[model samples]
Target: MQVFVTGTAGFIGYHLARRLLEDGHVVTGFDGVTDYYDVSLKRSRLAALQQYPQFSAIEGRLEDAGLLSETLERAQAEIVVHLAAQAGVRYSIEQPQSYISANLVGTANLLEAVRAHKPRHLLMASTSSVYGGNTKLPFSERDAADAPISLYAATKKSNEVMAHSYAHLFDIPTTMLRFFTVYGPWGRPDMALFKFVSAILAGQPIEIFGEGKMRRDFTFVDDLIEAMIRIMPLRPELGQPLQGDSLSAVAPYRVVNLAGGHPELLMDFVAAIETALGHKAAYTIKPMQAGDPRETAADTALLRELVGDLPRTPIKAGVASFVAWYRQYYRV
Candidate 1:
């Protein structure tokens, strides 16, 4: 199988591409190499992928309409996984325009490319943040996600709608995965675990937003890739939706939440990092920022019924793996 994956240089994308390549699939990766975080880290990830003969990567943004179209056609991608986006909730608040250009507009460009060269399955990344302002304990696919608290969440929700339209109009079998807080080895620096680990290791005070009261469903990266691969083979049909809360009814488009199933407290997560690194964190508590949810817990029963399993990576073990990788990679 030949797969076209965007954001190949990203944490999740890198892991996903590696897994696909190891599974004997030819993968073509598209990434912009943006300076949103450490560009060197992105480069290092791409470098590792380039070692695989079956993997090819192109450095370009999703909004580059011409480049994206050409690559999609050239790769002759059978499966398209759109993961490239200007990701970060707090960053979205400061730079809303970037989110619009990448998450929203970039998604539109990818959809256009997919429309031109229809794939067997189009799996794109959405975030659990779309369940904004919803007081629901465990958010399910059937819940109404009309109210997004941030521009980032709004764009992801818009992507779901946009993809649904494409699926309905063009009969594209599409799945929008609403990922929970994904964390693991080679993770992004912006995420809580990564930031906390780095600050603690460097003997710096880690900022605790919302006074360490927030909770998140932190899914491990390997489990995330496995679930994605499993779901890729099962495409939804045009009109027939799966029974129960498994699939969408309107079109061949359904939003599935891939999560760890357990929402861990922020302080507990920080404690896990401290335990792993053998050091306590210097904490500076602060108020919660706008567009930030106090807690995120996924109702992954729909995902489990479809894929038959959810991410089961325990926080302590996951943090240890990340710390080991970070030390090795940075030679700390």
Candidate 2:
């Protein structure tokens, strides 16, 4: 199979591309290698992918419509996975237009390119943040996702609806994955786990926002990739949905959560890092930050139905894997 993947320089994208190459698939990866974080980390991810003969990559932003369309047509991809975007909740508050340009305009161009050259199965990344301001215990895909508190979430929500329209009109089999708080080796520096680990290693006090009371459904990167591969073959059809399904009645599209159903407390996550690195973290508690939900839990019934039972790596073990990778990568 030939797979076209975006954001190949990113953590999730790098891991997924490697897995596909290992599975003997030819993967054409695209990434802008933006300076949103350390470019060295992004370069390292690209370097790892470059080692695989079956993997090739192009450096370009999603906003570059002609480049994206040209790359997609050149790959002749059977499986198209769109993962590139400007990601950050608080950062979205500061730079809303970036989200609009990347998530909105970039995605629109991708859809148009897909419309021109239809793939067998099209999978794109959404976020669990779309269920914003919903007090539902476990956010379900069937629930209304109309109210997005942040520009980032709003853009993703728009992507879902926009994709649904394309799927309906073009008869393209599409699946939108609403990822939870994903964490693992080669994690992004802006993410909480990376910050905690980096701060602890530097003998600096880690900032605990929301007074260490926030909760998140942390999905391991490996498990998320596993789910994606499994679900790739199970493309949605324009038909009646099964129980607990988020399939659209009007389109050959559905939204699935790529996460464990359980949500862990912020402090518990901190404790896991402590257990992993064997260092007690000094904390500076702070009030809840803007553009963040107090807690996010996923209802992954649809996911389990589509992809069987998830790997559900425990927070402690996941943290240990990340810590080891961080130490080895940075020689800390």
Candidate 3:
């Protein structure tokens, strides 16, 4: 299989691209190596992927439409997974224009490239944050996701509709994956787990947002990759919806939640980190930040129907694995 994956230097993209390469598939990765967090970390991930002979990488921003189109044309990818975007909920509040440039414009360019190349299957990343301001537990893909609290979520929601339009007009089969809180080895530094572990190890106080009252459906990175691998082949067909499907009536487009379907409290997650690090963390309880949700839960009926019996890694084990990796990587 020939796959073109954007955000290859990112956490989820790195895992997905590595898995594909290990399976002996030809993977052409694209990344801008932005300094959103740490450029060194992104460079390390790209270096790891470069070790694989089957893996090739292109260093360019998604905003560069000509480069993206030309690369897609040369790769001639059978499958295209769009994952690159300016990610960070609170950061989006600080730099809203970055979101517009990366999430909105970047995705629009990728869709155009895909429209021209016409891949067999197109999988784009969405977010559970799109189910904003809705007090519904276990969010379903069939539910309305029109109200997004943060600019980041709003951009992702825009991507979904944008892809739908292209799918309808260009006859592209597209699947939009709404991911919950994804964390594991080689995770992003801005994420909760990494911050908690780092603070605890350095004997610094960690800040617990929402006064430790928020809940999240945490999905391990490996589980997310597994679900994605299974979903890559199952393209949506019009009028062929499955039970509890989010398949579109007009286009070969569908939205599915990729998560463990289990919600855990913020305090419990912190406890797991403490257990993994063998050090109790000194933390201060703080009010929830703007545009942040009190809780997020995903209804995975559609996911299970599509990919049966996925591996759900326990929080303690997952945190432990990340701690181990963090210690080794940072030499802490």
Off by over 4 Å in 3: none
Error of 3 at 289 (Å): 0.7
- As for model 3, its CA RMSD to the true structure in angstroms is 0.5
Check candidate 2 and list the clashing pairs.
none
Task: Name the regions of candidate 1 deviating beyond 4 angstroms.
Answer: none
Q: For model 1, how does the per-residue alpha-carbon lDDT over 195-299 read when each residue is reduced to its tens digit?
A: 888888889999999888999898888889989999998888856665555455667887888997899998998888989999988999999988899999998
Ten contiguous residues minimizing lDDT sum, candidate 1: 238-247
Candidate 3 per-residue lDDT over residues 1-332, each given as its tens digit = 99999999999999999999999999999999999999999999999999999899999999999999999999999999999999999999999999999999999999999999999999999999999988878899988998899999999999999999999999999999999999999999999999999889999999999989999999999999999999999999999999999999999999999999999999999999989999999999999999999999999999999989999999999999999999999999
Write down the lDDT of every candidate, Cα atoms only: 0.91, 0.93, 0.95
Candidate 2 local lDDT, 77-155, one digit each (tens)? 9999999998989999998889999999999999999999999999999999999999987999999988898999999
CA lDDT for candidate 1: 0.91
| lDDT score at residue 32, model 1, on the 0-100 scale | 98
Candidate 2 lDDT at 172 equals: 91
Q: Return the lDDT, model 1, position 191.
A: 87
